[model samples]
Structures are given as C-alpha cells and as structure tokens.
Target: MTHTPLLKPVWLSMTLLLVWLLSACQRETDLVEPTTNTTVSNTAENETINKWILENMRDYYYWNDKIPASPDLTLAPSDFFDSLLYTYSATAAPDGDRFSWIEENADDLSASLSGESTTTGLEFMLYLRSQGSTDVIAQVLYVLPNSPAARAGFKRGDIISKVNGQPITTTNYASLLYSGATNYSFGLAEVQNSALVDTDKTLSVTATVFQANPVFLDSIYTAGTKTVGYLVYNQFVPAPNNSSGTEYDDQVDAIFSNFKARGVNELILDLRYNPGGYTSSSANLASLIGKNISTSSVYFREEWNSTLTPYIKQEYGDEFFVQRFLNKSQNIGGNLQRVFVLTTDGTASSSELIINGLRPYMTVTTIGTTTYGKNVGSITIVDDSGKIKWGMQPIVFKSFNSQGQSDYSAGFAPSIEVQEPLVLKPLGDITEPLLNEALYQITGNRLARRAVATGHSLPALGSSIQRKAGGGRMIKSLTAFKTAKLPQ
Candidate 1:
C-alpha cells in the first residue's frame, strides 16, 4: 500500500479528547454565573465554550503555564479566549502569544487554511496618501484569478481612492470595505506629482466564495546562459478545497517536472506574498529544491509543551514530531547549488520554514525585505462532539531546523535587500525590482536604480493578507493525535 500524504480531510478527523495537564482551578461544572452585565447572549453556552477553550489552551498552548489560574468564564467567548492568552505586549511580554486565534465558525477557519474564503478577491495594501495624512489609498496586489476583483479588471498596482463615491480615510475605509457587504464599487486614482488625482472611473465587484489557487504563476527564464525557474507561489496550500486531493501540490510538482525537463539550472522561488499554509505542501516544495535530500533528511523538528511532548512520544513514537523531505521524483536541487527566494514582510511560517529548512542543505539567498518571522506552528482544534461550534487555532509548537535553530520572531533580513517600488510591476516580470536584484546577484547583472519620487510613496499601513487569519501558520495534521484520550 502506498503511503498517503496527510491532507486537510484526514486532519479534520481528529478526536478532541486529549489528556492534558490541567492547572489547579475550579472544575467546569463548578463555575458560577457572573453578576456583572456582559455581552454574551447565552451565558451558560458561552461558559461551556470558554471551558473548552481553557482546556485546549492548557493542553497545547506553547505558554500553557502562563494562562491565568482563574479566567473570567462569563465573558463573551472571544473575550474569554483572549483573557486566557499570554498576549504579546511590546513592553510587558514581548515573547507572548501573537498568533493564537479563535473563530466562531470552525468551517470558516478550516476553509481559510485551505485558501477558501468569502472574499472580494481584492488583495491590496492600504497606504497613507502622504506622510502624516489621514487620507488612505488602497493599492491592488494580485487579485485571485476568477474572483470578483479579477472579474472587475483589478490588476496589481491599480489605486483606489474612493469607495461608494466617497474619499477613503483612515476612519472609514474599514467600514466601507469590510462591512459584511457583498457588493462594492471603487473609484480609481493615479499618483500625479506626489498627489492622488481621482479619475472618472469606477469598478464594481461582488464578493463570493473564492478558492485561491496558491500557485499564482510559474515561468522559466533564461538569464545569462542559466536556465532559471521562477515560481510565484502565494501560499502553501495543497489544494483549493481542503479535500484529500493534492491539486495545488500536484501543480507545483508538475511545474518542477517542467523545470527539470527543460534543464533549468537556477531557481528563483518567489514567495514575497506568501503568508503560509500547510506544512505538508511546504515540505513538498522543499523536497523539490533541497539539494541531496531524501525521506530520511530532517526538514524540521517540533517542540511542544511538556505534557504534549511526552504524550506524543508515548502515543506516536519518537519520529512522530519530526518532518522529513518527501521523495519527489522531479527534484531539481541536484542541478543547482543555491536557490534565490524573494521575500517580503508577508513571507512567513511555512515560507520561512522552506528557507530555514533548506539552508542546512544548500545556499539559500533571500532577496527583498525582512520576513514576517514566525517560527511557531499551530493546529486546528474543533470539538468533534458537536457541542462546541467554535474552532481554536492555538500555538502548539515551535519548529527548528536540523541545526536546532528557530530564532526568527523578529523576522529574517534579506541577503540582498530590495524594497519593491510603490509602482508595482507584474509578478514574474524580469524588470520587477525584487526579482531583478536576485538575477543581478546570480549573474552579476547591474541592479536597476528605480527611485520612488520623494513625496509620492508612503509606507504601507497594511495589506489584505498580511494579518489574515492563519497567516504565518504551520498546521499539524490531526492524524498525529488520533490515538489521544483524556486522562482518566
């Protein structure tokens, strides 16, 4: 029998009852009702939900011991969840939780993990019109292929200055764009002499359930006698639907197969916009690029809490937490000694995993800005008993490369730092700033000095996907916990 690669469907078959080391606290059945006025609709139900949250956090949270001894159980479910977190505060607790999140609907959370979501497909960056200005402009990043934004002709670098015919400002952009609305109209603008000049143009789009294909674009480039393979991998999803199917992973494998067939000697793995997904796909990508690697080669190691560490060992054996390279037939790492990874602040979790995991095996040169720096990984926790509808994606482990290094919380600074220009170029284009720098570094080609006009460019406030749910996340499959049972 062939070993099936673990995917989302198999991971969702997890049993929720895991034996956890609980702190000394009041039992869930002994909880008292709060006298204070609260926002929760059903106090009893919310308490039940909070009980579930507390139990899981105590069992799996990286900072499990840091959870409060007596959290407010009467608070709203989301608030109660927050109260249990050792939340990261720059001055107070810098190393605290930064990525643990709870979603009301586990289905949405699961869909997000697989790159499916109800979205306008208009991924963008919000920038202050000018320094110290409240006026904001939304610059389009790459839109999903067949979604509303793409259908409305939204391409990368298009600027939106108004929403619903009103000029967008810091105070109203969120309300205008993300107000649980399905339809939206955007008014266009152009950067003229350091100012946004509104145009007589409008684009209307309707948000829908869009399954973004992680493989955005792939091409083979010939730069200075070197056959180069450039892949714009936006996420680490194996498939669009989160099924057992490996559609997206197959696409990556096929791309690598083409690269191998064409004798591509150099590789430019563009992950500048990648925010991470499944570790399975990350391992797949690494297997395609890692030099002299095999199923026995260590890709990364997981460090869990003491309770889980020993439990996993006893339940699943020693090699259970260790991830290894897949034995991919189309691997091209043998033809190349170094790989160029283009990155940005959005490059995170599994993206960083690929970079860190490959460094021990080959020369991994990164171009563009610093990475998002998420070395920790998470797991999707859903109550299989059907009583709890909420899903918890809590930090479960910290991952280290084979050298036992996992210190990238502040992010990885690029080997060749190239800040992409405000005026974005089409991805996979040779003239693009980040890719150009990578080519220059590889072939000794002169780097282009493209200057952003002094007052025209503003620092990006944020992007649509930068802080997206599950961004910089590496999820462990539920199959690893199949044999789990609550302590008697």
Candidate 2:
C-alpha cells in the first residue's frame, strides 16, 4: 500500500477514504489546535486515550460547541467517544449526530473504507421469520462475483435459516453471522406458498480477504427509438487495492464513454447498496451526468465548524469551500433530460449527494425506497505515534448542494416507490423490479408482470449483516487545507 504523509487523518462524510500528502514542516496544530490542556491525568484507566479523543473531538467534531466542557475521563475509549457525541434520539435529539463511530483497529477501518475486507462476499438482509416471531432469516441480496459465496452457489434470493446448525434469532444473529469465523455452513430454506420452509440442504463457504470493485454492472437497452444506460454502482471508491490512483473512477468514466458512444439517452443509476465513499469520485460521476457543466461549475460545497471554517476562508478564500464539476469527454448528460436512480434504505452519504447535486441540472427521479438519511460527514483520525490503536471517525462537516440545499436529514423520499419483492431477481436483468420500473418510465411501456403464488412478501425489517463499510459519506483531503500556511 502507498502511504501518504497525511494518512494519519482523513476527512470523510460517512464512508470516505482519502490519503493526502501535506508538507513535512506543517504541524498538525496548524489546522486544529487542541483546546484542553496536556496536563490531564494520564495514569487513569484509558485517560491517555480518552484525553487524545477529547482534544480531537473539541477541535474537529461538527457539534464541537455542544460537547461538555469537562467530560468523564475514566470511561473506555469507545464509550468516551460516544459520550461526547450530540447523539440523535428519535424523541430527545432528532437533529443530533448519528454516524460518528470509533473502531479498535485503525488499519482494519482503513482497509474496510477502501473496499478491502475479509469476507464470504455475502451481502444480505435480515427478516423476521414471522410477523411477531424473534426468529430471523437472512436473504442473500447480491453476492460479489467470483467470491466464496458465489462459488458455493449462493445466488440472489437464497435464504439462510441457520448457521452451523443453530437457528438464527434476533439476539444471536450478529454474533452467529459475524463471529470472525474462517468458514460457515449455512442451513438453507425457501419461501414456499408464503411460508418459510426449512430444507435439509446446506452449503458451506470460507472467508478470505477480498477487495470489491464498486462498478458492479453496466449495460445498454434499446427499445424502439429510445436507448437507456443502466449502471449498478455499489460504492464510490476511486481505486482498488489501496492504491493512490483513480482506477475505479477511470473505469466509471470508461463505462460512460461506452454509453455516450452507443447513443444512449436515458440513464438509470442503481445505488441501492452504495453506502458512500470518496467525494472526489462522486463529483466525477455527477459531472458525467450533470448537463451543461464545466470544471468551474459548482458541484457541491462543504461547511466546517466555526473555527476551521474561518481559517480555511482566510487561508484559501471562499472558493476553497466549493467543489466543481470535472470536464470529462464522456459526459452523457447533454443527451439526456432526466436520470432515474434506484435506491433503498442502504443508499446514503455520497450516494445522496449525487442525487442532490444533479437535481439542479436535470430531472433526478428516484425509485425504490427512502434513502439512509445522512447529510453530515466525518474525519478519520489515527494516532500517528502508533501508541493509540483505536481510530476515531468523528462528524466534522455538513455537505450542501450548489444551490445551498442540505435539508435531507430524514432522507430523500422516492418519487416512484417500489420495494424489492421477497422473491428477488438477479440485478442487471431488465425484468428486475427496480430496473423494470426505470425501463417502463423511459419507454412508457411496462413489461408483462409475472404472477405470484401469493400476495405475501417478507416484511422488511431493515436489519442486515453484510461485509461493507461506510454508509452516507464524502471524503476530502486535508492536504488542501494544510498546504495553506497557518499563522503561528
């Protein structure tokens, strides 16, 4: 892996990864100066780590002003990190922080943010076996191609009732599914006649370190005089294999290049499983779809805390806060009037940003369900000294579109609502529920519906156990801010 100088701290929305290189002479305090004194009790249990946490939180957290002046220093690092957040509660604090988190291993967190993790590549959702029962069933959403799960014949819509011969319940599912085991034997089941029928069939798979490519699928469908481009983009990663290059972003460009070359007019961006990643990639995507835009056209803007905001303004001027569209040769927005987005509860952060950012330029019609409401972002802080093993992802900024619209905290509701049915179809199949709807909207002719055996579909519990990272995030390089010399 190529390590940059500013790898110690990365600014992110919800799921963001950026490695920046800052000047060797620049001090960490140049951008964020710790408020608390350094003489706090270091001998207390976890005080040393907690003190470091407090200092960073005080400097960079979006709700920095709301944090208590003197917090409990004796709490564990994770607990202490939680105590400082202006937590979002449904009734108590509806507008508080909900995405900031701390992980024990910074390396693991970094790897996960970069789309690298150990897994069976089983993306799934959890559903209650019955309306009132605690028993849970795991439905395979979409297995990563060539993954262990795919090699084991786990396809979309496959159901898992048990793991290691033990029934999956609401209480034990997390530990049973994510037990860090090297291998697993899944007990299979099927939804027959609206009832879950357990079968004696079992399939076992092993977990291995895998790096997923965010560009899942892309194709073109021609109907009469209209041509549509369909892309299933699962994440916004700019690269693969922890490289500093923009390989993934370049692949997206190439996909659009093909779309534009093929005379495609209509577009369907599938972001149902995209949690969010690199903001730079998001801009790259939006630029390709935003009609009549240029490199100077404002794409989105960032709003940091009071301290860093004014400092950035003073150092780099107002333009520093704005991100502009990149001039790409493969832009297809010029040939399109509207774009359809496929979404779900899992769609978040940079995913939402794309929708919000493009609406001002074109017709952005969303399908499927409401998004995973997350408009704010965080900064990934790892101890450069290597003494503190924990990594802190603190919400450091809120994002807004070019028109200054940032009020989608409850998530953007779909214009045309459709849910993924209990019986799933393989993605990229034009007959799939979401894609079918998009094609119908474009061609004005709906495909013949397949009759179902029963009207009952699995109740969506919104619970899932998947090997993915970062939902609702945008990442920016701190090097942009560090390059501007700060006053001593």
Q: Provide the overall lDDT of each model, using Cα atoms, as 2-decimal numbers.
A: 0.77, 0.76
Error of 2 at 454 (Å): 9.9
Clashes of 2: 7
Could you give me the TM-score of model 2 versus the true structure? 0.89
Q: What is the TM-score of each candidate against the true structure?
A: 0.90, 0.89
For model 1, the superposed segments whose C-alpha errors exceed 4 Å read 1-41, 446-457, 485-488
Provide the global lDDT of candidate 2 against the true structure. Answer: 0.76
Instruction: Kindly list the per-residue Cα lDDT of model 1 for residues 1-488, writing each as its tens digit.
Output: 11122111213321111101111001111223444775556787887888877877777788898989999887877778778888778899988777776778777777777888788898887888888999999988788888888888999989999998889898997678656678888999986785569899999998898888889899887756788898999888887665878899999999999999999999999988887778888899999999999899999998878765776676677787799999999999999999999988888888999989999999999988898778888788777666677777777788899999988887889997778666778887777888777777666663343422222358667776764554667765665465543332
Give the worst 10-residue stretch by lDDT in candidate 1: 16-25
**Residue 430 Cα positional deviation in candidate 2, in Å, after optimal superposition:** 1.5
